[model samples]
Target: MTLAPVEYAVIEFGDSTVTGDLVPALTELVETGLVHVIDLVFLSKDADGTVTVLELDDLPEGTAAAFAGLEHDIDDLVNETDLQVEAELLSPGTSAVVIVWENLWAQRFSDAVLASGGVLLDSQKVPQDVAAAALAAHLASLD
Candidate 1:
């Protein structure tokens, strides 16, 4: 079987935003063949500098509802070291989620490129504001 390219992302949330707010979009991504969730971990830092890591099965009722009926390929791929990194970056009173996912839709294409002996270069996600600015500038120049 061809292996999907894996990617990890860390989402930091302010005290106001909760996991529930972000679930719908992520569910849609998985449903639309964007990616497969290999592991999802939520970390909350207490005022006493304690970070609690919650796996899918350990999620709170309200938080678990976010994954309502969504497919979770839970592989427990994110280990303690990953949690430690998240803990270090999270604020004492804030929360964050670390996600490890595979780009399922890109597997075949990536395999083909590899088969052709092509060296993969860099991949970067353009910041939303920068992309918007570039688009606006191009449109203005065309007008």
Candidate 2:
């Protein structure tokens, strides 16, 4: 089977809690076949900067239940090194979620490019702040 482009993200929360508020949006993406969740891990950093990785069963009952249905295609794809890197970015009292996903909708385009002998030499994502600033500048210039 052709593989889609995979991406990972670390989302930090101000506090040490997983409220499952994003479940609905995530479910919608999966339901619509836009993306497939590969792996998801929750982590928390204590006041002393100690990081603890939490399993799904370790979450609050409601949160655990909310994520129970989101299946991972491959487990532990986000390894210890990945977690350590993301943990360094979290504040002492904060928590974070590390998610790895495949862009399912891009599979067809990727396959077509490969079939046509096109090569992806490089790819990069602009930082959110940078992209937002660029958009704002472009809009202002048009005014």
Q: Which candidate has the top score in TM-score? A: 2
**Clashes per candidate, residues 3 or more apart or on different chains:** 0, 0
Candidate 1 matches the true fold with a TM-score of: 0.83
Please give the RMSD to the true structure for each candidate, in Å.
2.2, 1.4
Which residue pairs come into collision in candidate 1?
none
Error of 2 at 56 (Å): 0.8
For model 1, residues 1-143, the per-residue Cα lDDT tens digits are 66688888878787723467777888888989988877777888877779888765677688877764556575567788877976898877777888788898899889999999987798888989999999999999998
lDDT of each: 0.79, 0.89
lDDT of 2 by residue, 1-143 (tens): 87799998888999988678888888899899999999989999999999999878888899989987887778788888988888999999998888788999999999999999999999899999999999999999999
After superposition, candidate 2 runs with Cα above 4 Å error: none
